[model samples]
Target: MTTETRPPAAPPRVDTSRRTRAPLHLGWWLAAAVIGLTLLNIGSVVVRSPNLDWSVVWEYFLSTDVLAGLARTVELTAIAMACGIVGGVILAVMRLSPVPVVSWAAKSYVWFFRGTPLLVHILFWYNLAALVPAIAVEIPFGPTLFEVDTNDLITPLLAAVIALGLNEAAYMAEVVRGGLLSVDPGQTEAAKALGMTHRQTLRRVVVPQALRVVIPPTGNQVISMLKASALVSVTSTPELLYSVQVIYNNNFKTIPLLVVASAWYLIVTSVLYVVQHHLERRFSRGTGRG
Candidate 1:
């Protein structure tokens, strides 16, 4: 039809000024509320319990014996880690050697140490006198050069150190090997292209870079070693847990003494965490994670 047609009137506009709201996340809120209440209840109970004896905890928290034990624990951690680092480096290099016998020897060492229980290792070292009776330095086909009774040579403290250190070495060898492996092959080739020898490339290029990957785990190992020092108490080497045990045995205030030990552990571990954080940050520089 020729009749003028006006566009159909626009449909009546719907009001969208009031948009639908999102759900309130009631389930998550409820769960958080329940968790908060549970934690609060537990805290209240722990704080108010008559059996806890907070005063006794404070009494022995920094006693001389406990302090000495803490020092021994730190000493063990330091010595064991030093031994582990040196031994681990040697084993890692041997494991990566071109000679099959060398590699196999390293592998065997790691396998034997890692597979056995550390407790047994500690006990074995402590009782080494029973097995070998004596330690001697001798010429294979000639006269003995030196001899010392095993018991005399391996005192309880020495036994603990040797056991902990050797055990730690097996684990550290794997750690060091993994770190070395993390370095790019291209970097080694580049170092060789610049006329670097194998040792030179490792010492100058590979190790420095590998430290970035190696340090964090090494720090963790130190913390673990600190805690593990407690096991040395079996050898009657006084460390943190053992010191606490001696006190509780005499006074029979077991829980409070245990609390003291636990408190010290928490404090020390917290300090280690801080140190580890700083070390990680120092090494992680230039990497975005830093």
Candidate 2:
């Protein structure tokens, strides 16, 4: 009663005039430094008078073979990503399985694939025909089925796709598992209470919710896979980089050819970034304080 009588406690001393500011203003300082360094670098390049031939860049872009190579690159990315997503979902489920054996197997698969460098995986797949001369099929604890020649069955393209997809699946499995784990247990419980089976709960409740958490990283993975498609050139898959190498090797226009490939990569990645922004917004809507 005495405190309440003390002029309403000075209105609790709200510091309404306290102007909050960032302690360091580091962002503005960093931006200015970056601009200064970039200008300096550009000035140095200009002073060096390095040949900046726009005509060669244009010619490389307009070339039919380069266009074909670009198409093949896109095709490879799509196929590999499709395979990776499917394989990853299966692996994620396996890893989360109640059975110890299934979970262990999934963990081992992910460990082996992820521990190994992707380039090595690609090389191994390319040489898989040499390692295992014949491919055999047999049911578990059953007689062997008809066998096929491994070398004959696996083309370089197929090997590249398998290698990239399987390797990517390992990483994507972790991403998916993380997303699934991020979802509340109550969601699954609620779905089960509503008479949904485990599979139905996962499909209708879990995956849809997890996808919001998954899409950003998955989109980044897709972009990376597009770039990684260039690695197939080591196996002579005639993808974007391989085609550019062929052109330059013929005409010795190495710089121009590289620039062409770079331009296409930049353009594609920029478009992908825009798509990713829209996808993130679409998925994030209604899931939060938005």
Best by lDDT: 1
Model 1 Cα lDDT, one tens digit per residue, 46-136: 7998888999988999899999999998899899999999999899989999999999999999999999999999999999999999899
Evaluate model 1: give its lDDT.
Answer: 0.92
Clashing pairs in 1: none
lDDT of 2 by residue, 85-194 (tens): 99999999999999999999999999999898888978888899788988999999999997888878888899899999999999899999999999999999899999
**For every model shown, what is its TM-score relative to the native structure?**
0.87, 0.84
Off by over 4 Å in 2: 1-34, 43-48, 136-148
Best by the TM-score measure: 1
- The alpha-carbon RMSD values of the candidates against the true structure, listed in the order shown, are 8.1, 4.1
Backbone steric clashes in candidate 2, count: 0
lDDT of each: 0.92, 0.89
